[model samples]
Target: MMFENTLAFARKLDAEDPLKNYREQFYIPQQNGKEVIYFCGNSLGLQPKSVRKLVEEELEKWQNLAVEGHFTGDNPWFTYHKQFKEPVARLVGALPHEVIVMNNLTTNLHLMLVSFYQPSGKRIKIITEKGAFPSDQYALESQVRYHGHNPDEVIIELAPREGECTLRTEDIISTIEQHSQELALVMMGGLNYYTGQVFDMQAITDAGHKAGAYVGFDLAHAAGNIMLDLHAWQVDFAVWCTYKYLNSSPGGVAGAFIHEKHAANTQLPRFAGWWGHREEERFQMKKGFIPIYGADGWQLANAPILLMAAHKAALAIFDEVGMEAVSRKSKKLTGYLEYMLKSNPVMEKRIQIITPENPAERGSQLSLLVKEGGKQLFEAISAAGVIADWREPNAIRVAPAPLYNSFEEVFRFHEILSGHLR
Candidate 1:
């Protein structure tokens, strides 16, 4: 498809977009009196208009039913988390029993590590990408320390080749192969937060298993942004936050996936709570922690109803439209953003796109490596009604969310950006 730089052309594309109407579902932020072009979905998505209504229903149930709300309400609090099984599983291409909406991403990551990261004699090392999200890095460091191992010795950080912005799949697979004898676990962000590079999860999972190690992904950026098949890929486990592409409210309740193979293993070590006990036996309040059948067994507490309400409201949109359609528009929208950025000769000299050029290897985000005054440029765009993200040192990250962002807004962004290139 030929992409033209003209606003008229952008409007034509938006006019033709099948998902354009869905934009009305969300409340876009405003600057002064005008709506801003939001490109920060990678950081936090805009609120869905339906959120308030859903949340109010839950509040009404609590007020009307009191303690009986657990069993009496429309969406009973007793089994609230169960409703998401089908939709969340469908969203990430996993079996319903393999997925659970529960605690936040890092907490779930710790639970996954407890079960999967069983380091043993001679196999005490864990492999992960260099510059992982700080939460992951901290979690790995603390976990290693808990097990009486030095983080420097137990954790192997794989880096991109010098001058390259992202890791090559070959390099990642070879790194797993190189330390096969000592590798206990392989964990990484499914889509890198900074570079916006989507890793080959299937390849990485296969390589990790071949090396006799467990594989997991921190899907904080991947879950709703890209098409994932954790079950098909045989990833041991995965976790993701909902506030970004899933568009739940701020710090929304998160989700986790455990392949049926692992989820069914009741004997697997996990930090369990009463909510994870078998439903039939839960009220009995017995001594032994007899786990539930699958991913539900990993839950540490009862659902946070309000947060889950927001999540449910947000996921309904995905359930209606489907991930395949969402992914298609994401590729086209992000591609247009890249094309618009690269079309200018001045930008060629001033900015470098650090994200993978191949649509298959990236999500909606494109990280621009500004040659100079990157933060100042980011502030300029922000001041002109563009809500983008800036990471330390240089890059300005922009994500044209397919769910709400329009092609015309992307063009407007390019126009605003071009004005400040000097």
Candidate 2:
């Protein structure tokens, strides 16, 4: 679709958007008594207007029911997390039993590694992308150390081909095949946090399996931003946080997915907890740890009701519109953002987009690399009521979220940025 750089054109697209009403569901942040142009959903999403009421209802249940709230509320606290299964399953394209809302992303990653990253004999190596989110890098390094192996020898970091900003799928597949003999696990972010590049998960999963390895993903940036098919892709496992594109409150409950193939395997090693024990016999308080049959078996504790409430509020919006619709709007929103940035004569000459140019290779985010005065440009935009993200040493990341961001805001951001370009 050809885009025009005029306010009228942006407003026209906004008026015609099928999901345009969704913007009213969220509470956009205000700066100096005005709504700021928010393009930071890749870092943190705007809060849904319904969150307060959902959370208040939970508070009321606790106030009225006390200890009985565990089993007596509208959504019983005892089985609170179960309600998320269907909606989240739909989002990730998995069976209801394959997904579960649980601890934060990194904790779930460690739990997944316990079950899937068993390195033995000649198969003692793990492959991941270079410069992954810091938590992922730390998790891999520590996991290797915990097994008494040197990270330098046991972990392979795949880098971009010399001059490229993003990794090539061919390079990733070949890396998996190259270490096939010793590869025990292949893990990567579904959408890279820094470059905003969306990796080919299906291809990576197939290559990993053929290479005799377990595969998983950190979908922090991919979960609500892109349409995923964890089950169809045969991903061994995956984890994601809810605060970014999912629009749950900060530090909201995270989620996990374990393929059905592994979910029912009771003998799989895990750090067990009482909540994961078979529900029917849970109250019997038996000495043995009899596991539940699926992803729920991986739970380490009972649900955090308030956080889950916030998650529920946000997911209801996703369920209403459906991922296919959300993804369609997302492509157009980011495309407009990209087009406007490129059309700015000053910006086009002074900056470069580090994100993959193809829409299929990214979601809503576009990472810009300024040739000079990167920090100054970031500050100038911020002062002008544009809320974008800046990474140290150069890139400025902007994501025009489909649920709440408007095409007019995208055009306005371009106008603000153009005025700041050196």
TM for every model, in the order presented, reads 0.99, 0.99
Tens digit of lDDT per residue, candidate 1, span 161-223? Answer: 998989999999999999999999999999999999999999999999999999999999988
Residue 301, model 2, lDDT: 92
Against the reference, the lDDT scores of all candidates come to 0.93, 0.94
Using alpha carbons, what is the TM-score of model 1? 0.99
Q: Which window of 10 residues has the lowest lDDT sum in candidate 2? A: 413-422
- Which ranges of candidate 2 are over 4 A from the true structure? none
Give the best candidate by lDDT: 2
Minimum summed lDDT over a 10-residue window in model 1 is located at 262-271
